[model samples]
Target: MTTISDGVTVVDHPLVRHKLTLMREKDRSTKSFRQLLNEIGMLLCYEVTRDLPMEMTEIETPLTKSMQPIIAGKKMVFAPILRAGVGFLDGMLELVPAARVAHIGLYRDPNTLQAVEYYFKAPSDIAERMVVVMDPMLATANSAVAAIDRLKERGAKDLRFVCLLAAPEGIERFRGAHPDVRIWTAAIDEKLNEHGYIVPGLGDAGDRMFGTR
Candidate 1:
């Protein structure tokens, strides 16, 4: 497990690693890519919510009474940074069907390489629940940073960031920018390319996911 710093976790499970390898391949079909993304998303979700508060509640079995542990609190909010982020939704939803979803749309300007927001919609009570921001890539950290900023503006307090891959520079920038938010990712690659793309990354996640390119 590679540790970048506090508030960052790299999932070291074999299953996560194996699936990530397939996703990183250039020849992966769109259908297969989407399926692998969902499967991996579910795996990452498990680790992300590992420490959620749980309380024991009284329960009755067919032959006896017992206490079972249940998650304590309002349903979690899944905030996917639209486009590429939507690819992770199905898998996360499968694990947390009751989770509320919020959409944040951001695009990077080629010249400035900065995140520009086009849309933002979230639950009014999002601040009352834990929010997990999902995106498949964290390359320049522009989009991730902006998305979290918007979430905070909308009253979201407890938040976590999850992604499939990240560049070392991106992770460093993000961690420095948002030290309070925990980051979870499958792998942290070498660095960002000249155009702000993660080296050894699976190319444009949005394009691969939707077959746009």
Candidate 2:
């Protein structure tokens, strides 16, 4: 892992980079792209949860009794921002099946490039749990910032943001809006394009994942 700043980490694992490169190929099929994303999601999940608190638990073995470390405290919530973010859920769930899910639906306006929320659902006790927000690309950060704003209004305190790729502009915007929340990403690209997409990023993650235009 590489620390870009006090709260930003880049997961530079070889497998993650390899899979991400495959997903970036122009001719990659929908099925292959989705599969690679899921795999990378699992890998990223491992990196992001590395510092979770642990407690010793007593267990009986055939030969003797022993204590083992297990995750402690209330289960975390995985908050995915709409269509593209959902692509990261299944792989993360494979590693953290007990985690609760929160869905935040927001779409970017073509003209203004602002986030508009359409749906929000989360646990009533969200205030008591850690929340990890997932989005594949942090291009303009409009959607990410809006999603976190809603979650904070709902009483979420401890929160983190994860993405497959990030643009420098998006990072700056997101940090400026929500500096308290840490970020984990596989790679931080150069910058955002004229249309607010990350340059060198796999285009339109939602459309690519869902096979939509």
lDDT of 1 by residue, 74-98 (tens): 9899999989999889999999999
Write the residue-wise lDDT of candidate 2 on 124-201 in tens digits: 999999999999999999999999999999999999999999999999999999999999999999888899999899
TM-score of each: 0.97, 0.98
Return the top candidate by lDDT.
Answer: 2
lDDT of each prediction vs. the true structure? Answer: 0.92, 0.94
Provide the clashing-pair count of each candidate structure: 0, 0
Residue-level lDDT for 195 in candidate 1 = 97
Whole-model lDDT, model 1: 0.92
Question: lDDT (0-100) at residue 165 of candidate 1?
Answer: 94
Steric clash pairs (candidate 2): none
Candidate 1 all-Cα RMSD: 1.0
TM-score of 2: 0.98
Q: Who wins the TM-score comparison?
A: 2
